[model samples]
Target: MTDDLDTPVLDNHLHLDPRHGRGIDAVEDFVHLGGTHLLVVNKPSWHLGVEPDEPADFRPVFEETIDAVDAATEVLPGRAWPVLGVHPGLISRLVDERGFEPEAARDLMQGGLEVASEFVADGEALALKSGRPHYEVSDAVWDASNAVTRRAFELGAALDCAVQLHTEATEDLTDLAAVAEEVGLDPATVVKHYAEGRLAGVTPSVMSEKDRLERAAESGEPFLMETDFVDDPEKPGMVLGPKTVPRRVRWLVENGHDEAVRRAHVETPAAVYGIDTEATLE
Candidate 1:
């Protein structure tokens, strides 16, 4: 499986939780199946047992993500870049578990994003991650989550990097694109993680399922491919497996979707994240 393809196979969103999951071994699974690159995203702070009272508290979470990226780069066949930020669902935790007001929760998330942005600025990470809750929430909490997402967009604009979003599953992402535009960030650089298909205005990091991959590939528009591999030991392959993207890329190629492979794995990621996918593959 690893010998047939010459083009880069990049997974746009993945997580590595060494304390609780397969960690670098999961990354090895990806590379062994022919994946050439990864955008290793940060898990939620609470997942890492970090309770943030202020911005500086997010450092350890971001550092953990960076460390995972470094470890993957050190031992894996492909490259791994860090994407760090506050998980949108953290707003719910802050309000419900931490006893923070909605507005205060939003502020703390924004501050956490600020710290994540500094990592991008310092070249420790490639992009910033942010989004609203994927489940039902109070209107105020939803508003706060959006505010935090907007702050992420602002930071992405300042750093000239990509922003990976983890929002509710939706077919239309025109509203998210509008927010990116309002924040002076290019909508093309706003990636909808766990995306099902090609969105109208925003970049879709389509999940590597046959149906979704077929739909996005058939669209012929620039898009990215991801597994959203949570890498949790208990749930083991909760969202998707690490080898899914590379395997899907092979499927696309066999189905004569070479252009889609180039667009999703090479062109789109390079344009959005400013990484030389071809060079990295070499």
Candidate 2:
């Protein structure tokens, strides 16, 4: 393939789970394919079905995520960043005492993310004492998560690294913006890929994407477009064919949407990942 993405070609979302072909093979492939850095996200212990009922027993997922990133950075030299978090897939658990009822969290086994709290303590606290888990957005939870995001952002700033996040629902994106702002993060600091499925209420490819794109444009926040994943045709999707970015870049050269596209796919991500915009995509 062409080194079109060689400019930075960073994939923020990747897994270490062997079942999804995520382990070393995945890392090797990404490096081979020109991924300068990968944000490796990890999960909590409960998902493996072996854990203490106590929140105190579980470690913050970020700890492991950081470890993974550190290891990758050492091994890859200039590739692999760690994205730390618990997915909101556990909305039920946090909001209801009946949270972990049989089959309640079973959905997590399949790419679920609602479990990890930005604040490991909060998620664990809720997990242990949440009398009535409510899936609806909780200010307390958001606040706690915001704090954790800030810590992570500050950590990134210290190392000049990018922070990967779980951006699912409209609320999730809202949280992302809030946390980014709270952490004094430039929109470009967030590296998101395949993070859509989080928003349950917002139907895919619906009216939200236009709003997202418009927001990205207005804020000069560059977002990403990944290929090979599902997209909601109703929205503006970033996933382009291997040729999509080039074609779109060519199209923009020959058409409009250049300013917006440049900000979203190029400027934003490049700035966040510390890549040179003029470095040449290939």
Give me the candidate number with maximum TM-score.
Answer: 1
TM-scores of the candidates are 0.97, 0.47
lDDT (tens digit, per residue) of candidate 2 on 1-282: 334532444343444543222345445545554444444555434453334344333344444545555555554425554444444444435435545533333323211222333323242211110111124445654444444445554544444455554433343454455555565655345544443323221111111233343444444334553332112233224343222333333333344555755554446546655544334322
Candidate 2 — what's its lDDT?
A: 0.40
The positional error of residue 195 in candidate 1, measured at the CA in angstroms, is: 0.6
Give the clashing pairs for model 1. Answer: none
Q: What is the clash count for each candidate, in the order shown?
A: 0, 28
Off by over 4 Å in 1: none
Q: What is the clash tally of candidate 1?
A: 0
Lowest lDDT sum, 10 consecutive residues, model 2, at 124-133
**lDDT per residue, candidate 1, 1-282, as tens digits?**
587788888999989998799998888888888888888999888888999999999999999888889888876555889999999988888899879999999998999999999999999899999999999999999999988989999999989999999999897889989999998999999999998877877899998899999999999888999888887778884989998988999999999999999999888988898898888664
Question: Residue 60 CA error for candidate 1 (Å)?
Answer: 0.5
Q: Indicate the residue-level lDDT of 260 in model 1.
A: 94
